[model samples]
Target: MLGQKNPPVDRGQATAIIVFILGLGALLPWNFFVTASLYFKERLAVNVAVNMTLNMVVNGTHAGHTKDYNFDSWMAFLSMLPLLLFTLLNSFLYQWVRERVRVAFSMVAILLLFSLTAALVRVQMEPDTFFSITMATIWFINTFSAVLQGSLFGMVGLLPSRYSTLFMSGQGLAGIFAAVAMLISVLSNADGINAALGYFITPCVAMVAILACYTLLPHLEFARFYLNRDETDKQPIEKMPIKSRDKTVLKNSEDPKDPEAPVLQDYKLPEKHTHNQPRLSVFAVFKKIWVMAACITCIFGVTLAVFPVITVKVQTSYRGYTRWDKVFTCVCCFIMFNSMDLVGRSVPSLVQWPRKESRLFPVVVVSRVLFIPLLMMCNIPDSKLGTIFSHDFAFVVIMALFAFSNGYFASLCMAYAPQLVRSRDCETAGALMTFFLALGLSLGASISFLFGYLV
Candidate 1:
């Protein structure tokens, strides 16, 4: 018995893996939407007359008076507004709808919306109609995804701190996966519409997996243990009626149930007493985390402003193999940012510098503003500002650093937030952080329009 091993908890990190996948599912739809920017542009750029002409033959030209559909501007405005509204609304909606119902319903809504999105790929409509429908669909999709995302973060916060990190890392992976999916979607078929038909289905598959993971999460021993502990943590110490104040304590006592796992004490409930930390008001929780929330908000805000909207327009003048020129945006910008972002998100698990409480953390986040101009000065075609970082290499390098910092600081803020508050307020803080992130996204997305114009 001297060296018997304890039974494993989260053996092989199965729970961790599930948590990661759940995180992946949480943001997969948004990633897919971001990655498929070109596809949407292609579909919406043409008028009904052009679309019909293309169907009769194989292709059409941009020669005629085309609809002035600014897809990027519309997309930026539509997607995040509902997302912002719904994310905040979820905190209140939790009163009427249970969290599980909200999550399950949100996933189902996204599935249906994407199904509609996929179905539209083959059918050509007037640019006006298509744009309207697309914008409405995006609004609804973000509406639901906001609920799912905010709720998932709150749920993950109830678990160990590491799970929160895993969850964030999973979202980072979602971006990477979407980027790869973009590559495949663009390359597999010459026809953009057909490629998108397949492209939209991937998230449907990811949704099934996400829903399954959510269902399986409650069944996991490790997840349940911490979840139960969180509930106990929330209960006021006074609520547990103390049978007696006199308590017997045992030290170094082995839980006979698990001989190798040492139990620090086998003790009775102490007399009811107030914990030193009081329950925080919602505003108080926000006050504790506002700095990080703002950091994360601004971080996302800045990233979105310059990313696909402007970065997608960046052209690399470096003479490449001719074929590489065609897919430059897909490779250099989308995939590059995402892969670097995933790397940045993962780094916190190893080295999270600029401790959350440090003055230096926000300073670093604020400094990322330079990226907006650095990216603007890249090889964007027809820019008010001419390209200085004209080569693909320069643009790629700037974007990599920009994206890495976005993931690194943002993850630190998210992971640090729940820790900075009372246990009962951890989930609340997580939800509030989700709202700020949306706030940042909404603001960044709006500003991105201006950035897009400046470029």
Candidate 2:
């Protein structure tokens, strides 16, 4: 039976855990930025005058300023540039090397950089250091993480659909974990230094754990099974040993001590089948999944354009909710979105609707652009015009829907992409898909800046 050569189904649970962890680690850098959002608003000066004053009298524009400068949208936009550029570069290089190599390299770089950055932040407690220095560190960490995520998701695409689903769910989990931590910090009335330390401690611990997982992954029986499948697919028939009447002679040839291999009786090399199943070119894979890629790009782009920047800025006009406003706007929204997103991603494991080959996926994705207007109409600050969906409840509901759709559509696109091409080119299809994801994030981040001004 063909079942003899198939991977054991029992290994699914272990593989799922590994893929989930991989997804978690890949998105941790971004999570670090989001979770530490409060620190940025507090420590980094946005106003030129405040920066000058801090620089001359205190540590140059590095200390916490009294005046708050709305830098979220601009920070989102600026942050994506390096990530977008490096994702493309990594995607291009994927055509030449294995995804594991790139993933490993990026992971090591991430660990070292984060360790170094955390140490610098700890030692240089003076608020006077250049904000540019901090921004530079953030940018580089994001850039490397972009490459790491592209490679990791691409690798996941080569596996079963459930792996990619779990991977996405893990990303949502990171957001949930972060949101909960921030909420706890707020409730406990932690000082600024203690709060910042919380953010630093979480990643340092997570990164170390992730590094151990990566090291052990290759040795896991579950991981090895999929890797073996990949190797089998790439090896030609001619390279395999031919059946022989003199099994002893063939066995002798395989022995490392036998410098001169013995000729086996009634053995002949297998014929190569090059005419069938040629590898798909990168562009060909792109064309096959361009619509899917577009859906991913648009989904992320629309999300990046609004979230935390525009959506997080909107709060109730009530006076009593002032103390909890930041918590409600930033932390609660993130938790709601992340929870809904986890549900959305998990749904595909049970039901893969609107098949990847169907035209409906892209249509559904494009329709999401409508959320842009809907979100903008919420109770935003300084708006003279009244909105029908002005209430906080309505905003939370919309955010839930927005996040759910994002997870569902993104998971579908990624899981479906590799299926469109030959097994050998699945990774390429994945890398191409990751490229579009970055493109979407970049587009959305850029659009966020404009929306910030408008809001």
Best by TM-score: 1
Q: Tell me the number of clashing residue pairs for each predicted model.
A: 0, 4
- TM for every model, in the order presented, reads 0.85, 0.82
Candidate 2 global lDDT: 0.71
Task: Encode model 1's per-residue lDDT on 246-364: one tens digit a residue.
Answer: 22222223354774552222112322442445557778888898898889899999988887788888876865667688778889998888888888888887887898768998898
Model 1, residue 238: distance off in Å is 16
Candidate 2: 10-residue stretch with minimal lDDT: 1-10
RMSD of each: 6.1, 8.9
Which residue pairs collide in model 2, if any?
55-60, 59-128, 62-127, 63-127
What's the C-alpha lDDT at position 300 in model 1? 93
Residues 208-297, model 2: lDDT tens digits: 787777677777665565545356553321122245323443443444344333222212232345325666777788888888888889
Off by over 4 Å in 1: 1-8, 50-64, 124-127, 234-279
TM-score of 2: 0.82
In model 1, state the lDDT of residue 153: 84
lDDT to native, each model: 0.77, 0.71
